[model samples]
Structures are given as structure tokens and as C-alpha cells.
Target chain A: MVHKALKIARVMLSVYYAYMVEYRAELVFWVLSGTFPLILMGLWVEAAQGDRFDLTPTELVQYFLAVFLVRQFTVVWVIWEFEREVVEGRLSSYLLQPVDPAWRHFFSHVSERFARLPFAFLLVGLFLLLYPYAAWLPRLDNLLLGLLATVLAFCLRFLMQYTFALAAFWIERASALEQFWFLPYTFLSGMVAPLALFPDAVRAAVLWTPFPYLIYFPASLLINRPDHVAQGFAAMVLWSALFWGLNRWLWRQGLRQYSGMGA
Target chain B: MERYLKVLRLFWGTAIAAELEYRLNFIITALISLGGLVGSLFGLFLFYRTGYQFAGWSWEEALLVLGLFTVLQGFSTTLLIPNLNKIVTQVQQGTLDFVLLKPISSQFWLSTRVISPWGLPDVLFGLVMIGYSGDRLGLTWADYGLALLPLTFGAITLYSLWFMLGATSIWFVKIYNVTEVLRGLLEAGRFPIAAYPAAYRVFFTFVVPVAFLTTVPAQTMLHQGGRGWLLASGLLAIVLALLANRFWRFALRFYTSASS
Candidate 1:
């Protein structure tokens, strides 16, 4: 079992390195894409106007800066990867591999996020230095919970997105499907604005959905008050389990369809 | 002009036929798109409920901006998406050579290669929203025309900028995130430019051009300004388009295909 696991890990790691080498320039370009968030940060800061919002202007600044950092830390690019592989017949290469293709893809996906950390941290430090308020925003306990929540959030997001991609097995032109999934998540995932800032009904609705656990939970852990962290963490673990089970069921059904082609 | 129209007609016809092969997909996808539109509006509605106006513009104005944004996005997806998506393969595999050898302008042909007819739904929806907003905001026809002209110009500027970025794929070969960055930046336009305050208004208007892309155009529809600014922005788009064409030609020289 150890030998098999190590072999799979080694192969996926090599694929990750290969992807980095091939797309190094694209990686740099993506890192530059962080500029938009910074621009939004500046804009939102000025608009807040001396603690005009519920939080102080500095607090607003800290919120967006944390958002930028957490987003960079947790962003996933697998939806496109899965869609492309299926659409372009590239899944054949993965199918030939001895280990499960989804597992290999997940490892590589995690590696990409890991590889991006140095740059994400650099930006976080810059934000911290420029806006000292952000550095003091998170308590140690919440920070720890945030980190743990981020891991679960990543797993839940991966499961949900993988299921969405698996739907491509049965559908053609999956871009619309991908877009449909992404657009709502953009709002509910707390990428647009805080769920707390959302109307009470909207906030309740988002909380009930799995989307907030993807990004909002980690972001809220950092930005929200200390009292809110434990609740957010509990919510995350619950959603993670729900999505994981859903993903497992979908994968099993999808595999059945694949094997039944011969039957 | 007639030739261009004919080209558009033929391409759009082919695209619709191709897309219609999966007709249920159109309904499902459109329904999904409607869900997204509703979600966006839900966010906007929540913001409005808290206060009468955000920054300076009212809900009606914000909707207009969103409508313009959706229309431009539809235009890009319908016209440029299919073509620009192939840039990586064209460069990596050297299949761009086939495109270059074609009788028409390589840049034009390559840029307009595939059209997604379904994208028209977004454009239609955008027009409807703009009309509804104009009526609610008490905008006159002259004001609407003024706004439409600049928005048309802004849309062209957006297309030109995308063309330049897409052309960069000839050299970089893997800048898929370029479009994503554009999309992300454009998302800021969902709210009024005033919502962001002064520096952001400047950033959106001058630097990233997001204001011209949506907010300013939407504002013009509400009679925020006469046609002068819109005309100037339109002229700016023409110049940008010229520059993009020049860059496209320059990038072509660097296109050593992976396939070759």
C-alpha cells in the first residue's frame, strides 16, 4: 500500500512540475491578475470614507486585503482542466494511468496552489506593512481555525467542482454549465461581498447552501469578529462532508456509465 | 461593408446550425444563464435595500450598467471566444499557418473563426434592461441615442483590447488568464463607478477602461452627458483598434508554430 501510494504521488508530482515548466509565463501572468483585487481594495477603502460602513475604513481595507490573500491561497482551476480534458479527448491519457485520474488531478491541483503560496505571501506581507490594521485583525485561535477551515474548504470545493466537471461526461459544450456554477458561487462564495453584509434572507440562504464554505468561511474567519469563527468552522465541516458524499456517489455513477459502454 | 455583413451572415448561420444539434442544451444553458442574471441582481438588490443609492447612482442606473456589461460579454463570447480560444493550440501546434494562408486577412479570419449564436440572448436581454431602465429613469430618446453611441464605442474598445491581448498568445502561448483578468476587472463595473469613489473612478475610466466599458456608457443612457464624451471615446476605440491590428501583424511574425 505504501509503495503504491508513493508511486502515485511521485507521478502526480512530476506532472505538476511539468505543468509549471510549460506554463511558467502563464503563472506570472496569473499572479499579475491579483492587481484587480488591489485596485478594488483601494476603491473600496476610499468609498468607506472614515468608518462610513459598519466597519472602519481601515477595517474595510483589512477585509479586502485578507480577501485577496485568502482568495489567492484557496483558488481552484480544476473546472477548466476537467472540461478541457473531456472535451478535447485528453482524458484518454489520464485513463491510461494506473491510479485514479481524479486523484492524480487533485494532487496536481493542490500542488499548483502550494506553488503559488510564495507569491501570495509576498502580497500578504506587502498588504500587512502598508495597512498595519490587517496584521492585527485575526486572533490566534481564529487564525488556526481559518487554516483548518481552508483545508476543508478546499476539499469541499474540489468535490463540488469535480462533480460539475463529471457532468461534462453526459453533456456537450460544458462552458455554459461551468459559467452557471461559477456565477452564483461568485456571490454566495463571498467573492463579491461578505455574507453578513448580505440581506438577512440572502445571508440565511447562502449559509444553508454549500457555496459559502468554499471561500466565505475562510475569509470570514480572518475578517469577521472572533465570536463568529467557531460557527463558521462548524458550518464548513458540515458542508465539506455533504459535498464529499455527493461527489463520491456521482463518481461511482459516472464510472458505472463508463464501464457499461462495453456491456 | 456588404461583404462583411455577408461574412457575418454566413458565419452566424453555420454557428446556429452547429449549436442547434443539441437543442435542449440551449434551453438548459439559457435557464442556467437566467439563474446567473438573477443571482447578480439579487446581490444588487440587497445592496439597494440597505440604502437608496450606492455611492451616487440609484438601482435603475446600476441595472443599466449591468445590462451594458452583459451585452458586451455576450458580444465577446459570440464573436471572439471561439477564435481566441484556439490561440494556444495555434501557437503550440503551429496550425496558425493554415489560417495565415487563407485568402482573407489572417487577423480578421482568425479572430472571427467561430461564432456562438446563443450569446445573442444576452445581448437581447441587455437591450431590454436598458430600455426598461431608460423608461424608469425618464431618459429621452436623444439621451438614449447619446448613451448607445458611446457604449457602442466602448464595446469596440473592449473588443480591440481583447484582440491585442489575444494576439499576445502568439508570443506567450499560454496567457489564458489574460481573458480571466479582463473578466475579473470588468466585474467591478457591475456597480456604479461612483460607488468606488474618486480614485477608482479614475482607475476605471482611464487606466483599466472599465468605466468606458460599462459604467460611463450606462450613465450616458441616463443623460449623464451629451454625445461629446461618447464620440470621443468612440474615436479612442478606433485608434485602439488600429493599434491592435498593428500588434496582431507584429505578433504574427513571432508565430513559430509548435506543430511546425
Candidate 2:
């Protein structure tokens, strides 16, 4: 049974590999999307120059660079993909297979990350060599932990966003809701800046939210050993369980709706 | 001139009629737009809390920049973006043949195809913010009017550049990625150009030309920064438009209709 599941995962990976090859230009385009975060890093580093915050300028550089790395690895297309499949009735295609649809989707998500690894590695090396402060980056073990946390965070985010996307099956309009969910995540996820930079009240609010676990915690884990990696990972695991439950519930409900078993 | 006015009038009427058909959607979109404006203003407010001045500009001056950026962004949403954004799908699906077959200029048709009149609220909100900020900053009406002149030219330049980006779909089958790049570049407009370092300032002023779009307008109004920079931007716009027009023509030549 384990072997069969591994085979299924392999097949899913091959399919995504084929898709990526077929859309090679898109892969290049997606890599270029990393440029925006790098630009943000540039602006922040300049702002931090000769100015002391709680962290040094080099520390800020390491922080954002780590963010760029983790963000690329933790990316998922599940929200948009889930919406498209559900709306277009393509979920039926997935239902025909013996494997769980969510599992297949998650497998595809991981496969895409693997595909991005080449460019992601190249960017990391380039950033370290080219940027002013390469020495400030965390050690290799911390880097591995950062990678693990980021993977868990990606799974958590996927479950949450995919659950949100399943609302398309119920609502006539889900785009606004999807946008609402995403726009706040940009601020809250520490994509634009560290949650620490936020006002204390706002930072406190964000701590309980799932957003920080997505980008900030993993980033901080890699850049500097904050006093909170263990705590944040615990939070991420808890949220992951909750979101997984919510996703299972929603998927079951969505499937019933699809099967005309719901009012 | 009369023909152009007639086209504008016709497009305006159709847009209004289309908007009125789904008043609920219009209302929702308008409210969302207002929400977006508030979010943008709040972002500016956050930046202000950090310091009295950023990169040599006062907080109120920065507010003017935000207000002007909002206006330009509104203009895009209201006029150019909705219509042009669909160009890729239309081209890919072979529906652009209908557009090309029209008696009017294809550029004119595609550019003015869909104006989201509901987006006018953003314009109003932006103007209100600009007016209020100017009052608080003690800037006179003359400054605002003088600023408007260059900005008018800047707006046209920007619209033309964006249309050119959309027009590239005729050649490159997957120009959506290119459009995504532009969207990414638009984030650069969120902060004042001066706040950014020299590298970014040059890049925005020259490469992306966002400086011409937002900062120049705000600078003119708040600081009365001379027309020298504005004229240079205008000249750059003219060059870019001319090149874009040529590129458009080149792409048109490669267009074998995807239709059967």
C-alpha cells in the first residue's frame, strides 16, 4: 500500500514535470516574479544603511533574502487551481481516480516546488555572492530547519487557501472573497516586511493568525534564531491540523454538492 | 476631432448602460474600490508614523504623492486596464478578428472597448484626497493647476505605454507574463521616488517611468518642482510611444488570425 502510494506520487510528479516542460516559457516568467521581492529587499537595505534598528543593515539583508528563498519554496497554486477545477467541473476528472483528490493536488504542489529548485538555488547563490553582507546568513542546520518549517507552512497555507477556494462550489461569486483572503495575507504573512516592524498591537493580532507562520517564522528561523522557532513551529503544526480538518470537511461537503447529494 | 468626440461619447454611453444593468455588481465594485483607496491611504499613514520625512520629502508631501498615484491608478482601472487586459484572451481565442474587422482603428476600438464607469469613484476619492492634502499643506490652487498640466501629459503617456504592452499580444502568444511584470512594476509606485535609493530612482524614472506617472505630478503640486523634469519625462514618453507604435505595427504584421 505504501509502495502504491509512492507510485501514485511519482506519477503525479511526472505529470507536473511534463506540464512544466510544455510551459517552459512560463517557468522563466515565474522565476522573474522573484525580481519584485529582490527589489523590495533593495529598497529596505537602502533604508537601513547607516541606520540602526533592532537589527543591523546586514541582518535586514539576510532576513529578506531568507524570505525570498522560503517564499519561493512555500508557494502554491492550489487556491487558483482549486477554484478553476471546481468551477469548470474538472473536479470530476480527479474524482474518477482511486487516489484522493486533495492528496493528488498536494503532490502536484510539491512537484512544482521541486521543479523550481534549480532557479531557486541559483538565486540564493547569486544573492549571497552579490549582496553586501553574505556573512550574516544562518548556519546550514538552521537552513535545513527553515526548509522543513517552510514546507510545513506551505502545506498549512495550501489547506487553508484550498478550503477557501472550495467556496466557489457554493457561492455564485468567490473572487472577491478570494481577494479578501489574499490581500490581508500579503501584509500579515510578512511578505512585505517582518511582523516585528508592525505596531505592537498589530503584531500581537498577527501572532495568533496563520499568516506569520507562512513566511515570517520560517524566514526568521533561517536568518536568525529568534527565541520563537519552537513556539512558531508548534503553532504551525496546530494550524496545519485545524486547516487539514477544515479542508477534509469542506472537500467532503463539496464532493456531496458535486454529486447532487446536497440541496 | 468631431469623430473622436463621437467615439468617446458612444463608448461612454455604452459603458454607463452596461454598468447600470448590474447595479449591484457596480455598487459592490465601487465599495471595494473605496476600500482599496482606504487601504492605500493607511499604508501611507504607516510610513508617516515611522518618520517626519522620508528621503527629503515631508509627510504631507508624501501624502500628495499617494493621492496622485491613486488618481493615475484609478484612470487605468476606469479606462485602459479593463479593456486591454482582455486582449490576450481575445487574441488567444481568435475573437480579436471581430475587433480587427471594425471600420474604426483597431487601436481605438480595443483601447475604448470597455470603460468601467464604476471606477469613477476612485477618481473622485483621489481628487478629494489631493485637494484635502493640498489644503493641509498650504499649497495654493496655482500649484495644483500647474501640476495638472504635466500630469495630463503623463497620464496620456502612461495609457499609451500600457496599451502598447497589451498590443504585444498580437506577436507573443503568451504576453500575459509580460503584463504580470508590469503589475509587479506598479508596486514601485506605492512609495515616493525620492524615498528609494539612487538606483531605484533612476530605474523608476527611466526604465519603468513610474516617476513620470506619480511622483512628478505630486512634486509639482506640493513642491512646485519646475517643469524641467516634467518636460524631460514628456519627451521620454513621446519616444516610448513612438517606439511602442512601431512595435504594435510589427506585431500586427505577424498576426495570422487564429480563426478557422
Candidate 3:
């Protein structure tokens, strides 16, 4: 059974990887859009130069670049695709498949990370060239830990969004939920600023939420800060499991509620 | 001119009537905007909390820029996004033929076709923030009046650039995210131009003109930076507006449409 599952996973991954590569031109623009962190890096790096903050200018540059890389890997759009599927009743086609439809999204997102990686890394390289003084390699253990955390962050983000996508089963414009969810994720996730610079109370409060682990925790680990290592992983695992449970329950209930509206 | 105004009224009237059906979406978007406002405030506060101001900008001065940015955000949502984003869909679906066949200019119809009320909350909140901060800065009504010229120019400049980018869809076809790249870069406008490093200041000013969008108008409101920056912004808007029109006409020449 395990062997069969592994084979299926391999097939889905290869298929989605090809599909993602077919739109190579659009992929470039998508990569360019993630330059939000790089822009913030400009502001933060300058701010850090004053020595009022705990972080150095180089560290600020490093942190935001890591944020940029983490963002590219963890980006999830399952809600948008799933919303269209349910609204158009195209989900009926997926319902007939033997497998759970979630794997398709999971694999597609995973494969997209591969297709997106080259451009993302190229952008990182461009950023490094722009700020060569800030360029430094991560320690081996920290590199391993950061990569692992990034993959897990992607899963947690995907699960949370897909779980929210199931709301399309009940509501017509479920993406509105995502739009609302994104506001907090954009701010609380440390994409806007390092959690270190946040007010002590705000950072402590945000740490308990899933947002920081999605970008800040993994990014901080990558930058070799090494703070909150144990707690961050635990939070990510707990959130992932919670979302996974909620997602499965929603899928079953949605199937019953779904009437194949447009199909 | 009168005909265009009549058409715009009709376009927005029907658009609002249709969108009113999705009352829940308006509330959702408003809540989201409020949350965004709080988040933006929180972000700006982080820099100030450490007693670090963006060069010469105080908290209230910076708030003016943030407020103007929010207003432009609302303007885009209400007008720019609902209309310009559909350029890609039209190009993809070959519906541009119908648009071109219309009695009116295609760009006119395409740009003014939809108006969403969802952005009103952002506009409202933006004005409130402006007023709140304008009061804190002890600015008079005349000061607010002075900023309107640059603000209008800023909005025009933004619309022109966005339209020009959207017009590129005729060739690129799947250029939806191309416009998203513009939006992402415009996130720089959330803070004053002074907040960025000198290199960033030059890039935002010359490369993207994000500095014209928010900081120039904020400077006008504060009675700082004099009239030089304001004239440059107005001139930039006029130039971009004409270029967008020319580019749209140029792009239409290549519009072979889909499935041809």
C-alpha cells in the first residue's frame, strides 16, 4: 500500500511540475511580485543603520531576503482554484476520481515550488549582487532546519487555505475569507517587519499565532537567529494538524452539501 | 465630453446596482480594509516606537502619506482594478472585438466600465485619517485644498501607468500578474519617500514614480517641499496619460484576438 502511494505521489508531482513549467513567462512575473520583501529590505536596512535597533543593517538585509525566499516557497493559492472549481461545479469531475482531491493541490503546489525555485533563487542572487556586503551562507544545521521548516510552513499554509476553500461549499465568494485572512498574514507573519523589531508585547502575542511561523520563524532560523526553535516547530505542527482535521471534516460535509451547481 | 460623462454615469450606476446584490462582500471587504488600516498603522508605529523617524518625517507627516496611499488604494479598487483587470479577460476571450465595435472609444469604455462600492470604506477611512492628522498638524482647509491638485495628478499618473500595463495584455495575453507586479511595487507608497534609503528614493522617483503617488501630495499637505515637486508630479501625470492613450492605440494594432 505504501509503495502504491509513493508511486502515485511521484506521478502527480511530475505531472504538475510539467503543467507549472508550461507557463514559464507568467512564472517570471509571479516571481517578480514577491519582491515585496526586497523593497521592505531597502527601508529596514537603512533604518537599522542608525544602530537604534538590535539588528544590524546586514542582518536586516539577510532577514528580508530569507523572508523573500520563504514567501516564494510557502505561497498557496489553493483557495482561489478551489473556489472556481466549486462555483463552476468542475469539482464534480474531481469527486469521481479515486483519490482525495487534496493531493492534486498539494502536489501542484509542491511542484510549483520547483518551477518557481529557479526564478526565486535568481531573484535572491540578484538581491545579493545588489547588496553583496550582506551575502553570507547559513550554517549546515541551521540550513537543514530552515529548509525543513519552510516545507512544513508551506504545508500548514496550504492546509489552512484549502480548509478555508471548503467554505465555497457553503458560500459563493469564499475568497473574501482569504482576502481577510491575508491582511493579518501579511502583517503578523513578519513579512512586513522582523518580529524582533515589533513591540515586545506584540511580538509575544503574534508568536502564539500561526502567522509568524509561516514566514518569520523559518526566516529567522535561516538567518541563524536560532531563537524559539523548539516552540516554533511545535506551533507549526499543532496548527497543521488542527487545519488538517478541520479540512477533512469540511471536505466530507461539503461533498454532501455540493449539488454540482453549474455542472 | 458630455457624452463620456453620460456613459460613465450609466456604467457606474449599473455596476453598483449589480454589485449591491453582494452586500456581504462589501462588509467583508470593509472589515478587511479596517484590518488593513490597523495593520498599516501598526507597521508605521514600529519604526516610530524606536524613536526613529523616516529622515525628517514625523509620525503625523508620515500618516498623511499613508492616508493618501489608502485613498489611492480605494481609488484603484473602485475604478482601476474592476475595469483595467478585465482587459486581460477581454483579450483572452476575444470580447475586445465587441468593445471596439462600440460607438464610444474602446479605452474610454474599457476604463470606465465598472465602479465598485467596496472601496468606499477605504476612501472614507483615508479621509478620516487625513482629517485626524491634518488637525494634529494644525493645517487649515487651505492646506487640504492645496494637496488636492497633486493628489489628483497622483491618481491620474497611477491610472495611466496601470492602464498602460493592462494594455500590454493584448500581446502577452496572460499578463494578469504583470499588473500585480506593478501593484506590489506600489506598496512602497505606503510610507513617505524619505523613509527609504537614497538609492531607493531615486529608484522610486525615476523608475516607478511611486514618490509622486503619495509623498509629493503629503508634502503639499504639510506645506513642505515647495511647488517644484508638485509641478513635476503634474507634468508626469500629463505625460503618462498621453503615453497610455498612445500605447493603447498601438497595442490595439496587434490585437489579433483569441482563437484566431
Candidate 4:
């Protein structure tokens, strides 16, 4: 059964990859649309001129570049898709399928990464060429661990958003709820700034949340700071499991409610 | 002009009534807007904590720029974005034919058909923020009056840019993603244009005109610059509006109904 599922996943990945390629221009635009990190990078780089944040200007550039790369990997749009499907009664079709619908969404997102990789590499190359001073080579061990952490981060983010999307079963404003979640995520996940740059108390509180494991931990690893690698990985696994369980419970309840309405 | 105002009034009244039927949406929208405001403030707090001057603007001046950004965002999201997004779907499903067939001007009708009144809270919040920041900066009524001309021109410029983007959907139905690019670039407007690198400042000023959208108004209110930018903004708006009108006519010539 595991082998069969793996094979099915491969097939779905390839199919979705082809679909993404067909819409390659739109995909490029989507990728280019994540310029917020670069904007913050500019601000921080200028701020670093006074050498106040303990990070050199080059370090600030590297940190934000890492942020931009990790953000592309960990981003999830399942809430939007799932909300639309549930609200439009399209999930009923998915329910009739032999395979679980989550696998389909997972494969679609995974395939998007595959489609986006070449363009991402090109963009990174151009950026490095433009700013040679910002370039830094990470240790091999750090690079490998960062990759692993990024994969886990992606899974954790996808499952958490999917769990949130399950709210559509009861409320039409699930997307608004997602927006509410984004407010905290933006600050806590180190998207706005490095967690270290935040005040001590805020950083301490943010560290307790699962948000940092999604972006900050992986970004830190990529930049060769493996101080909390073990703890971060443990927290990531625990959060992913928690979200998975919650998603399963919500899915079952939502299915019951959905069918009760005769959808 | 009176006829157009009457038509807009009728359309907005019905749209508001239809939207109010979902009373919970107002609460949700208010919450989301509040969240956005808080998030931006938190970011400003972090930036200020590092030091006093951000790209040579004081904390209060920076806050004023953020307020301007919020106002423009609220206006665009409530009126321009939703209406423009509808063009994508209309073009895709051939519903645009109905829009074009109407006796009224299609561009005017398409742009004003829907209004998300729930977004008014963001507008009010932004105005209050501007007032508070302006008062902190010791801005007088004359300063605000000076800012008004440029602010109006900025709004026209933004509307023209968005209208041009929406008109492009007639040729490329999937151009909705271009709006995402516009939104991404708009994030830069949260800061003063001078905060960015010189190269980025040029790009935002000329290519996207984000500087006109937020920076100019804030500067005028702060009494930092003279009326030259205001006149430039008005001229740019007229030129862009004419160009957008031309493009809309050109795109209409290529419209093939999906039903056919």
C-alpha cells in the first residue's frame, strides 16, 4: 500500500508539474510578486550603516536573501484553494475519489516547487552577480541540514494552513480567518525582521510559538547558525504532528457536516 | 456629469445593501484591517528601535508616510481591485460582452459596479492616523491644504494605472497575476521612497510611480518640498489616463466573446 501511494504521488506530481509549465508565465509573475523580503532587505541594509543591529551590511543582505529563498519554499496557498472548494461544493467530488484529496493538494504544491526551481535559481544567480559583496558560502553540514529543515517547514506550513482551511465547513469567512493568522505569522516567523532584532521579551515569546520553526529556524540553519538545530527539529516534528491530527479531526467533522447538507 | 453621479449613486446603494446582508463580513473585515494596521505599526516600532532616522525621515514623518500608504491601500482594495478583478472573470467567461453591450461607457461601468464598504474602517483609521501623525509633526491646516492637490492627482494616477491593467485582460485573460505584481510593488510605498536604494527609487518613481502614491503627499504635508511635484503628478495622471483610454479601445477591438 505504501508503494502504491508513492507511485500515485509521483504520477500526480508529474501531471501537476506539466500543468504548471503550461502556465509558466503566470508562475514567473507569481514568483516575482514576492518582493517584500527584498524591500525589507533594503531598509535593513541602510539601517546597518550605523552598525546598530550587530549585523554588518553584508550579513543583513545574506539574511534577507536566505529569507527570500526560504519563504518561496515554505509558502502555502491551500487555505484559498480549500476554502473555494468547500464553499463551492467541489469537495464532494473529491470525497467520492478513492484517494484522499489532501494528497492531490500536496502533490500540486510540491510540483510548483519543481516548476519554480529553475527560475528561482536564475533569479538567485542574477542577484549574486549584481551584488557580489553579499555572497557567502555555508558549510556543507549546514546546507544539508537547512534543506531538511526547509522540507519539514514546508510540510508544517501546508498542514497548518490546511487545518485552518477546514474552518470553511462552518464559516464563509475562512479566508478572513487566514488573514488574521497571517498577522502573527508575519511578525513571529521573522519575515518582518530577524527574531534577534526584536526586543528580548518579544523574541522570547515568539520562540515559543511554532511560527519561527517555519521560517526563522530554517533560515538560521542556511546561514550557518545551527545553535538550536536539535530543538528546532523536535519542535517542527511536534507541530507538524499536532497540525496533522487536528486536520484529520477537522476533516472528518467537516465531511459529516458537508454531507448532512446533501452536498 | 449629473447623470453619471446618479448612476453611480444607484449602483453603490444597491451594492452596499447587498453586501450588508452578510453582516458578519463587516466584523471580519474590520478585524482584518485592524490586524494590517497593527502589523505595520509593529514593523515601524522595530525599525525605530534600531535608531532615530530611517532614510532621513523622523519617526513621526515615517508614521505619516505609513498612514498615506494605508489610505491608498484602503481605497484601492475597496474600489479598484475588486472591480478590476471582475474584468478577468468577465473576460474569461464571456460576460464582458454584456458589459460592452450596455448603452453606458463600459470602462466607467466596469470600474464602479461594486463597492466593498467594509473597507471604510481602514480609510477612517488611516485618516485618523494621518491626523495624529500630522499633529505630532506640528503640521498646520495650510500644510494639509497644500497636500490635497497632490493627493487628488495621486489617486487619479493610481486609478489610471489600475484601469490600464484591467483593460489588458481583454487581450490576456490570465493577466490577473499582474495585479499581484502591482501589489508587491506597492509594499515598497509603506516606507518613504528615499528609504530605498537610488536604483529602486528610480524604478518606483518612474516605472510604478509608487513615489507619487505615498511619498509626494507625505512630503507636501510635511512642507518638505514645493508644488512642483504636485503639478507633475497632475500632468502624469492626465497623460496616463489618456494612454489607458487608448489601450482600452485597442483591447476592445480584439474582444472575441467566449460563447462564440
Which candidate leads in lDDT?
A: 3
How does candidate 3 score on lDDT? 0.93
Q: What is candidate 3's TM-score against the reference? A: 0.99
Model 3: how far residue A19 lies from native, Å: 1.2
Please, what are the lDDT tens digits per residue for candidate 3 over residues A15-86?
Answer: 999999999999999999887898889889888888999999999999999999999999999999999999
- Highest-scoring model, DockQ: 3
Clashing pairs in 4: none
Per-prediction TM-score, chain B alone: 0.91, 0.92, 0.98, 0.96
Clash pairs of candidate 3? none
Tens digits of per-residue lDDT, candidate 2, B1-260, equal: 68877987998888789778876776667677677776666555544556635676777777777778777777888887788788888888888889888777777777787788766777788888888889998889898888987688678778777878888788777777776667678777767787776877888877888888888888777655676887887787788777766877777888887864
Best by TM-score: 3
Candidate 4 ranges beyond 4 A from true positions: A260-263
User: Which lDDT tens digits does candidate 1 get at residues A1-263?
Assistant: 99989887877887886776566667656775766456656655654564445656666676667667766766676778877777676776668777778887788877777677777777778777877755665778778877777787777777777777787666655566667777777667766566666777777877877787767677667764543566666777787777678777876776655432211
| Candidate 4 TM-score, C-alpha based | 0.97
Instruction: Please tell me which model should have the higher TM-score, number 2 or number 3.
Output: 3
Candidate 3 Cα deviation (angstroms), residue B237? 0.5
Model 4 Cα shift for residue A164 (angstroms): 1.0
Q: List the residue pairs that clash in candidate 2.
A: none
Position B131, candidate 2: lDDT: 87
Q: Which runs of model 1 end up more than 4 angstroms from their true locations?
A: A2-11, A32-43, A50-52, A83-98, A125-137, A172-178, A259-263, B1-5, B226-228
